[model samples]
Target: MNLKTIFFTIAFLASFHIFSQNTYVFLGSYNRDKEAESIQVYQLDSEGRLTKVASTTNVINPSYLTISPNGKYIYACTDTKTPNAGSISSFEFNPKNKTLTFLNKQTSGGENPVYISVHKNGKWLVNANYTDGSVAVHPLLENGIIDSMAQNIHYSDRSIHKERQTRSHVHSAVFSPEFDVLFLPDLGADKIRSYAFDENQKKPLTETQIPFTKTDLEAGPRHFTFHPNQKFGYCIEEMSGSISVYTYKNGILQQIQRINTHADEIKEGFESSDIHISPDGKFLYASNRGKENNIAVFSISENGFLKNIGYQSTFGDHPRIFAIDESGKFLVATNVISGNVIVFKRNPITGLLQKTGTEVKMENVSCVQIKKYY
Candidate 1:
């Protein structure tokens, strides 16, 4: 074959490989009755359209969900009221049958578990407890089931505002880019605390851990997102509905900017819920609940700053969290109270979102994560 012919053949093969991958979206629903006890799954096409693939499985109050690194198991946090009595469950994911088989359940170490994220090595599972303000690290068994707690840290910093920042309320727990430090966003403390992690040797961490605190006392930081390049991080303030950008270097975050999520003249009572950066690191999206329920979009400037682009109505009330497809063509915003997941088409060039009118019926959807399988 000629030189040009060989180059064309290689390009075509690379494009074909990516197109053959099947993407799936997992929705985590909170069932207070503890009857259904499962998660919902949907299939995503190349164009980012979703089709129901599997019915809801049996799991309990899955407030947050995360997939295993090998895609063999799924983990979730059950938001229960009993103090230090919530749970984290594991399931075997069957992509062919689009079903989940129960594996095991382990104590979450705290009450009101809100978020769960797995370590990069897939050996540890981290959880954020909202009620008691703690972070738990659980180990995974060889069979892909949860084993037990590796480390459980109880935050006692009640050193901020009184109304909202009375006690330490760990809202989120995520690993740094190098996986050397684990950062926990505590809403009630108005700070994001960082701890040095040792995966090889299970050791105890001290209370003198480094922390990042917001200027406003009642800001109530909720969710945090890391840049694709791993050089920057962004945290959304739930109470004040604002975004804080920081420079992440050597497991430390230095404040860069704090931008408001709501318009200056149009603020009457709103709280932020979820915050996510685009797959390509070009845009950021955050959910605002309360009187103004909308998803605010922002363009990432050259210096890693967020420039407010626009806001799109979620078409429902209380949009807690949303997920973006792997292809970056669609975004599904989960409306917990409105009982629907509003689908929107995302423009790649402009980083703007347009409603697609593709709504999925769901009850109390709080979290979503996308997975791709052949």
Candidate 2:
């Protein structure tokens, strides 16, 4: 090759390597006593190591977080148990400096706001309140600031579990792949409620005639996620420690299978927390907290059924949430009780995880999110 051509090729490869070397990670913590900051930002190297970049401390009980579709803003649920005291806060994210600037906060319309999801159109923010059993929708301004609650719906129903299901407890609010429907998983009601979402309307969500799908009595649906194909949905049951698979079509969900997240030998105290499917849709993963501090791995069949592959120990306590990187190359688990984050290298071919021996200590970390920063 000519000397000039070889030089240009070397420069192009160097730029690509630099672009692929790091990703931005954001962590939310449940810090009531001010032991640690509420939100933290870090740089995650390709080898799965974390280096602190920036942190903010004003927000309280920032247990969960979701990023905007444009990657310019982050929304977090400020989980407070006092009546009508919960709030959702928005922050502007700067990829250049890895810092977050507080934008604004608004009432969540209920207590103990736990989960937040942004609409694909970047005009709506939906949050689920766990303590007061309600769903709140907020309007997002063009500048990424969140306005007051546009709509709030309360659920009064209760399930069979007397103590835990005394009232409705909405654990998560997730949007469908097409962003035409919203699913709210109620941990205290044993049901997954669906709502039609229309971004064109002033009030974007309305109850459909077929509003919800019921799980087994006292099953306690905690979180819901959709398959990449948009034809299937899965719910992680917090109380039963099982996953319920369903066929989703035009905002309707039909249950297809229910499988245990724990081994048969380990029966009690299995509290499954979060669920995610691989980027390629070849595998599924769920986190178990109570007695079995591990992540269950399942292979996805062509028909959308899940087969149990194996489990990997988290090597920590109370893995409240875990996230797979956008590249599908690494998995990180944030252990709430242990106050440590564990990194696992994922095998793309086998769909299994191996510990990378990279741990970062962050007190009361409850959620971890990874995204590519360009």
Candidate 3:
């Protein structure tokens, strides 16, 4: 073939490969069936629709899941809500069939594990047990099996709230952007704990110099998200309906600002669950589960502070967890009580959402994640 013809052929193939890439939506739920369908994988199309393609029943309560850094495996929190029966399960993901094959599991080190986070190197994983108020670490095998629990740390502290903050409840253990630190949010203790992580060590997570950052008196910090600039961290306070902004550096976070997620004054039973930033770093969105069934949108200032800009009603009960497509085109939320998934088209410029009329039923869905696999 001539040079001109060859060049044209190569360009066409590259374009085809880009457009043919598939996007997948993984849902973890508190499903009634422990046999299968508790953790389902769906194919998300360009037109913003979800179609289920595969599922696994090997886990009892895969309420939370984390995709490995290499995107080749999935780790889940199983046996949730069963006292002292919590476990972390592993699976090998087959991209061709869009399925997850069960690998191995290890005790989660506490009861009612709520969240799991895998390191970027894919060599270690950690989980937060909500009921027993502890954290567990496990190393992942090269072949996708989870090794025995490496270390388990239990916290003993109490916050101001007599009802909910009576004891320590570690909600999530999130890795820093560089994967050198782990931030553990303790809901019942009103603190965001920090740890220095070294995956190569026998115990990968160790307490840092500034071990924890205390939140407001009744602010039950549930989840945290970092800005793309890596200088700012946002924590969603569950009971207070607020977001705490911090300046993060070297495994330390200094509080810079605290803003309410709701439009009105803070009240009881707000139950804010999740927080995320847009890919472009211009907007932040947080899900409110109780007292308001909506998403609170904020405009992120250059100084890393947030201003409440708008709100979008989820139109379903208990929007527990939501995922923003990496492409920044869609936002999908799982409403646990209503048993449905809602898809919304995102306006890139305005950082707003509009329902796309592509809702599906997935009873008791709890957590969601979206990714594009080439």
Candidate 4:
């Protein structure tokens, strides 16, 4: 090829590569019926548009998903709702083809496994069962198949609420940034239960010196996340519609502040669901589902306190889960009742969100996880 032709060809190839970059989005959902897809995949392009790529109905009610640290495997908390019917399913992600292949599954040792957390080393897989009020641990094989349940711990504690707190309901399993501690937010018990963990141990989880940190009565602590700085932790309360802020260290937590998670003048009956801090650690967001279907945004201080910024309407009902991509440029939220997925452009500096992307419709979309496939 001539030099002029070579330059033009190279420019065209570069443009194609940029246009084809992948932002693989994994969405999990409740089964509306037998034919519903429980887990689906999509590509999020540069313009905040989400285009369907592939989907799978291999598992039922894969409500929550977690990608392995290496990003080679994906695990889902499948079979939610029914008693004794929950399981954790694993899949191998073929990034080259942008597809997922079923690997293996193991009983989560309880029903309604709503959350899964894989160890940073990728050996231990932990999950929390909401219906059965239990926590289970499973070992991961080299090929990403989940082994049998290695340990199971059942919690019988009850909180003040007669209906919602009749028994412990573990809402999420989150590991400390250091991976040395595991925190389980038990919604029904109104506490953040924690454990000291070492993946090499036969039973990796052991209770910490402070087994749990009590929240307000009937607060219903749900999803938990640590600030990127690793100095603070936060959890969204489903019942109280609040975010409890804590200073964390040595697998223990000290409550520093508690702030409302709903929009101004909008209170009561807000069923809060997910909590996530921005990659820059400057912003924190929590989703409310019931009455006020919105996201409460906050600005973070150096001392780990939060100031309410504003709220963004999710424009859908029951936004059960939301995820911020690693770039901190796009935020995706999924609604279960409306069965719609919406992507928002994020302002990294102000921590506000704007609805500018494409909207997608999925059945019972309950969870969203975003990862770049480059």
Q: Count the backbone clashes (under 3 Å) in each candidate.
A: 4, 0, 2, 0
Q: Which stretches of candidate 4 lie over 4 Å from their true place?
A: 1-20
Give TM per candidate.
0.91, 0.95, 0.94, 0.94
| Pairs clashing within candidate 1 | 37-58, 37-59, 38-57, 38-59
Residue-wise lDDT of candidate 2 within 1-374, one digit each (tens)? 99999999999887556544548789998887544578998887767778888888767888899999888998998856545589899999897766789899999999899999999999999999999899999999999999978999999999988899999999999999999999999999899999999999989998899999999987899999999998899999999999999998999999999999998898777699999998998999999998999999999987789999999999889999999987788899999999999999999999999999889888888999888866
Candidate 2 whole-model C-alpha lDDT, 0 to 1: 0.90
Candidate 3 per-residue C-alpha lDDT over 1-374 given as tens digits, one digit per residue, 9 for 90 to 100 = 99999999999887545533577888898875666588888887766777888888857878998898777888888899876598889888887877788888899999999999998888899999998799999988898899988999999889888899999999998989999999999999999999999988999887777899999988999999999999999999988888999998887899999988886854567889999999999999999987688899999999999988899999899998999988888999989899889999899988999999888888788989887787
Candidate 1 — which residues are off by over 4 angstroms? Answer: 1-21, 56-58, 81-84, 159-161, 204-215
Cα lDDT computed for each candidate against the true fold: 0.81, 0.90, 0.88, 0.88
- Candidate 3 residue runs with Cα over 4 Å from true position: 1-21
lDDT of 1 by residue, 234-353 (tens): 999988779999998877788889999887776657588898888999999998887778999999987889999899999998999888776678888888898788888899999899
Select the stronger candidate by lDDT from 1 and 4.
4
Best by TM-score: 2
Structure candidate 2, residue pairs in collision: none
Candidate 2 TM-score versus the reference:
0.95
Candidate 3 achieves a global lDDT of: 0.88
In Å, residue 309's CA in model 1 sits off its true spot by 0.9
CA lDDT for candidate 1: 0.81
Q: Judging by lDDT against the true structure, name the best candidate.
A: 2
